[model samples]
Target: MEAWKEKFVSWFATSGRMNRAAFVKRFFGVNLVCMAAVLVIGSRVIEETGSVFASNLVSGVLAALAAVFLYSPMVRRLHDIGRDARLAQAYLCFGIPQGFLLGKVAALPPGSLGLYAFEAALAAVTLLFIVLVFHAGEPRRNAYGAVPGRAAAAQQTGRKKGRRLKKAGTV
Candidate 1:
């Protein structure tokens, strides 16, 4: 438990480097926080004034902007863990269709077990994909640049060398 806590702290403190578990945990935590905020504030606003559309629109826009801004850092963190940014694109590939299917199911006849089965399968597959992303192999140096932890160490060494040179008036 201590080790796990240390890993979380390290991942959060480091600029981009994070292990897969840490990355997944952080991603899920962010999503949960966003969902909670939307649920609480949106529910209050709607209950007080009965404007479901407005509340939904506001929450949707907020979530979209958060996703857009958070994506790059998330990608960078994935790179640090040795995964490709394309892995993050799984949501576009699988999640969108699943969401559409869900909507279709909701609109179907009341006694449709078929849609429920399909939805369950889709949910399982989505969960599997999330696990796969977290379990994917790490790269040595991905397109995001060198591995962050190593790069930081190298930078520190360079700075130390520069300082020594300066002290010797040979820089």
Candidate 2:
């Protein structure tokens, strides 16, 4: 738990050195929280007044904003995992269209089996890209500097530990 907190705080602070597992866990965690909030809030709004359009619109807008805020951090996390930020663009290219189609299918009256099928297919494709991003190759010396492993080792060894000077230009 402490490690998780540390990772979260560090990512918040510097957006640095997240491994594959960490990146996915954090990404999924954030998305899950956002999704759950949307579901709950949207359901409440619809149940209270039965305005599907309004509820859906609000949910969509919130989700889009959340995604906008999340994308940069996620890309940075991917960078920490040694992957290119361009991989993040995959969702924009593929997932958005699929999601739009799914939204349309969901809005259908009934007999929307095709929509569900399409949704399943989209989910599979999205998962595939996510897996690809998680398993993407890490560069040795990225623009962010050496990988986390080396930095952690250096921190542990005290070799690169920073120290305060005792007297101005002396020591």
Q: How does each model score on lDDT?
A: 0.61, 0.62
Model 2, span 21-46: residue lDDT tens: 65666667767877887899889999
Enumerate residue pairs that collide in model 2: none
Best by lDDT: 2
Each candidate structure's TM-score, on Cα atoms with residue i matched to residue i, is 0.56, 0.60
Q: Largest TM-score belongs to which candidate?
A: 2
Worst 10 residues of 2 by lDDT: 159-168
In angstroms, the error of model 2 at 168 is 21
Per-residue lDDT, model 2, residue 166, is 32
**TM-score, prediction 1:** 0.56
Could you tell me the TM-score of candidate 2? 0.60
